[model samples]
Structures are given as C-alpha cells and as structure tokens.
Target: MTASPSAARGLAARLADGPVICAEGYLFELERRGYLQAGAFVPEVVLEHPERVTALHEEFVHAGSDVVEAFTYYTHREKLRVIGAVDLLEPLNREALALASRVAADTGTLLAGNICNTNVYDPADPASADRARAMFTEQVGWAAEAGVDYVIGETFGFLGEALVALEVVREAGLPAVITMNLHEAPRTREGTELPEAMRRLADAGASVVGLNCGRGPATMLPLLAELVDAVPVPVAALPVPYRTDAAHPHFQALVDEAYPGLPSGRPFPTALDPFTCNRYEIADFARAATDAGAHYLGLCCGAAPHHVRAMAEALGRTPPASRYSEDMSRHVYFGSDPTLARLNLEYGRTL
Candidate 1:
C-alpha cells in the first residue's frame, strides 16, 4: 500500500531545505504541569489535557519548531503494566498520536509519534529483543494508523534494541528517527560507540538518526561529530539539561572519557559551578551542533519554550530556509582554547 501523503513527506524531506526543530518531554512533564494525574511513566496525558498538548504544540510552532513529538514515550504495554494500565496501551498510544496529529494539522507542523525504551535492557535474553520488537511494531503501527507524520524511537540505550524499534517502524511504512542516549564519550553503557551505533541504525532503515537525554551539549559534541561522519542521513541533536549537579564528579567524568585516547587513570577534574544559562546557552548549543553538522536541532528534557525559540532564530539566520535537505555541508567549530576539552577530559576518566 502507498504511504499516507503526510507520511510521504518523510522526516528527511521535511528537514532537507533547512533545520527542523523538535521538542522533547515525556508524560511526566505534562503531569507536573497539571495536565495529567500520573498513572504510568507514559500516562494518558492527552486524554486529560488535549488543550495543553495543543498549547505546547502551538508554542513550539510559534517558536519555529518544525516538528512536535507526541508524548507517548514509554507508552508500551509492559510499561503501562507497571502502573496498572496494561489494558490501556493500544488505546492510549492511539490517542496520543491522534492528539499530536490534531495539533499538527491545526498548526501546519509535523507530528512525530514518540516511542522510547523498552521495559528493561536485557541483552542476555533473546526474549527481551523479541518483546521489544513486538511492542515497537504494535506502537508504530498504531501511530501510523492514527496518522502521525513520522515515528521517533528516542532515548534508547542499546543499539540492539534501537534496531528492533527501527525495524517495526519500517514495517509500518513510516519514516523513523532513532535517538539514543550515551555517556560522555557517546557510547552506550556497554561501550558501543555513537558512530558505530548511527551506522547500524541507518543500515537498519532509520531515516534520521541522533542523540537525546544523556548529557547536555557540552558533553554531547564529541559524539555528534562522530555521528556526522558515520551516517549518510540527516542528523538531529536534542541535548537535555545535565542530569546531576554541576559539581558532581560523575557528570564531569563522562566528559573527560569521551575523547580519543584519553588516559584511563587520570585524576578527575573539579566540577564547574552551576549557573543559569537560559535561552542563550541553548542557542549556543544548537548553533554548535549545527556548525558541527546536525541538520535538525531542538531541545529535550529541562528545555523550555525560550530554548526552542533561540534555536529557531539561530537556524533562521544561518540557513535562510525552512525545508529539509541533504546537500548542506556539516560545519565544525573547534576553538584554539581547549578549556571544554580539558575539563571534559579531566572528568571523562572518572566514569
């Protein structure tokens, strides 16, 4: 069967002429905003706050986001079962997609159905892969049926599992974007490098590939550079706020270890004090990612409306276009000052 017209405008097509912005947040954020009562990790926020969902959609659009992902991350049956809503999986997933589609239709922006990590990461068991594949297939199929423009499997920690999610989206005849989470060096917890991961996902039929939810932009760049060289498709980079306090050694250690040939026994660097970066920091990161070759840029966890606006402004000034394209050259900006690299390296070995 032919794909839907909206779906036909694949993520690559939509992002080809220029940069595309995507907002990332799970159902928990919606609940925090009083739009939901918190049933599961991916509760039915849309059912209760369709307007709020719509409002966020409108805000992103106003801020110049080209795509808004539906809040369906962790909406799979196994995840819902943890919260006693096992029976509501299909309905809830469908509803989330529908709500996103409605917002997209009303605002002329693309809607991407968000599918996140599986119930658990169990590489030793083939059953885990099987279950993940099945869940992803069902969820992607439902998203397609509900008329999403595309499907995004995000915050993935394992390449094996990410490939399973990619397969399901392809079988459903929808374009897919796989965004994985990584430690300081852009490797999975098991040490699969970001470049290798991106290559594998592209081979598995992911139309767009990127990173999300692990570390902020400061720590994400090394991996983003590797990804630009690894994949032929457009790369999207959505960095979230730092997961730990700025002074936390664990966070700093990740940054230190991600660079090539870093010593394993180096002393850890002192953590940088925390400071409010506001939209300026976000804009700087987006610009850096774009300069480093990210074709699609946006915000993730802890990112607010202003951050998205800053990204849009950065893109607007640099590209002067609104559609996605592949001919664009990836830009890289490495400064003479090595403060970031030095600090990151100092922390990299601590992990």
Candidate 2:
C-alpha cells in the first residue's frame, strides 16, 4: 500500500514550499448544519446527502485552507455500529474522500484523509490493540487508494492509540499528521507528557505532530511553545473556540462544572458553550502560534468560516474568496496590545 514515487514527490514538494492552513471542526460544522446529531455523531450526513459534505470542504477551501480534509471524523466502522449502521462505514468513508478529493483538486488544495480517536485503544490489553490496528488499517487502505495527499490522525487521547495510528499510516505509505487532544497539564489521559509524546511520535514516524481539539489558544500557547521546541518536524494546532482563560484552562472542566449553568456531561450543551470566543481571540492565538513555530494552524470544534478568515488575516495571507469574507472595516475594539485614543486630543495616539 506504499505511495507511488510520483505521489511522494508531490507531497514533498508541497511541504518544501511552506506551511499550509488545515481547517477542521467538521463534526461541529455538520451539527450546526443540521445534518448530523450531537450525541450520536454518526456522520450519516455523508451517506444521505454527500453534497452537504462537499459543501463543507468548499467552505474550508474558500476560507483559505490549503488542505480540504475529508469529513470522516466519526465515520469509523464501530461508531456506525452503535446505530446499527456498521454496514455503511466503507461507503461513508469512501464517499467522503471522493467529495473531498474533487474539492481539493478543483480548488488546487491537497486532500487530507481524516481519522480520529476511536476510543477502543487500550495500552495494557492486546485484544484492544488488535481492534485499533484493524480500524486504522482499513481506513488507511481506503485513503491511500483514493490518492489522498496525506492523512491527518487527530484528537487522539491515548498515546498507545496515537502510535498505532501513525504506524498504520506510515506502513500504508502515506505521510501522517498526528495530534493529541491536550488539557492544561499537557499530557494524554493515559499520563504521557506532551514533550515525551512529541519525541515518541517523531521517532515512531509521524510526519507532523502537535496538539488539537481541546482548550483555546490562550491556554494552548504555553504547551505549543514546548512542543515546537521539542519536535524538529512541523507542528499543527486546531484548538476549540472557547474562552479557556488561565483560571479554567480545561474546557471540559468549564462544561463539567457548569460555568454559568448546572453541570451536565451532555455533548454540545448550549449553556455550557455560552463562553464562545470572538474573531479577535483566534487572531491573537494565530500570532502566538506562528511565533511559536506552529506552521499548520486552524480551528477545531465551534469554529466557523469567519474564524478561518481571521486566522488568514492574522497570518498576513489573503484568504480565498469566502461567503463570509474577511471584513476590512472591523476596527479593533480592545486587546492586550497597548492602545491610545485620539478622539478628544486628551491623550492622542495611533490606533
């Protein structure tokens, strides 16, 4: 299942040029579109109306993402099995890839086949490991056959499972981008420190590795600095768009404790999500990420196309025409950066 030499060369040439905008947050976007359920997370939208999925890819491409990731986050076979739809995994994944491929090629973007935390990985159990291998192998087989530019394995919580994903993707002959879902502690739930995790993933053959899915940019900056210094390879980040200030660096903790409402573990709780951030927050985060040497920057859950536009502008790049184009007239309200007012000439300074 190795990639053809020509394909390898193409990928290498793209990387050599520079970093790319790899926007994600598909599950959130689809849910917002009313195509997928929150608790179920079936991704049946791909099978029922693939045009919806294609339209999503088109949005990211328009938002200036150089990589149109296939929206197959929860499309894994076992996730489908939960709703008595195990039979749909192959078609779901393949069709998702097909739509992404068309969008990528048509828009001059790279197709990134997507995989995620299967939640079946167990470090101490051999049978659990076997199930994980089966899951990754099958998905990689499909992605490589579809000629994806590379595969992004993200939101991974367990180090053992993350390693298995990297191994499977590399064995299949496609480059791998692996990102773990990190909390304030900068360790996997399984207790592996992020620096150690980065070194291990790099040694284990992950082409690009970093953090994603949890915590906002304000909280991620410290962890990202350590990551960029630890790994020689490029780093990618797609953090959620929540306000995870220093007091509450963990989004789960905020939701679990019910920041303003009663604590509920319900997925996609609206009250729990009332602490949403604005475009300026992502712009500030992008500046810190670029300074920290993170090349692959993006948003994860709760992200919309406007956030992507802010990211592009913050990075000094012209975003491709998007439905919600970046507004030039939006003046900065306030930020950590020093500002001066020139209205009354009492204390005049440049904006």
Which predicted model would earn the best lDDT?
2
What TM-score does each of the candidates earn?
0.77, 0.87
Q: Model 1 off-target regions past 4 Å?
A: 1-8, 26-28, 36-40, 243-276, 317-351
Cα lDDT of all candidates, in order? 0.69, 0.79
Q: What's model 2's overall lDDT?
A: 0.79
User: Which lDDT tens digits does candidate 1 get at residues 212-272?
Assistant: 7656766676567778988998897887644333333133344333344435332122121
Q: Candidate 1: worst 10 consecutive residues by lDDT?
A: 267-276
RMSD of each: 11.7, 5.4
lDDT of 2 by residue, 177-211 (tens): 99999766779878988899999999888888998
Clashing pairs counted in every model: 18, 0
Which regions of candidate 2 are displaced past 4 Å? 1-12, 256-269, 322-351
TM-score, candidate 1, is 0.77
| Clashes by residue pair, model 2 | none
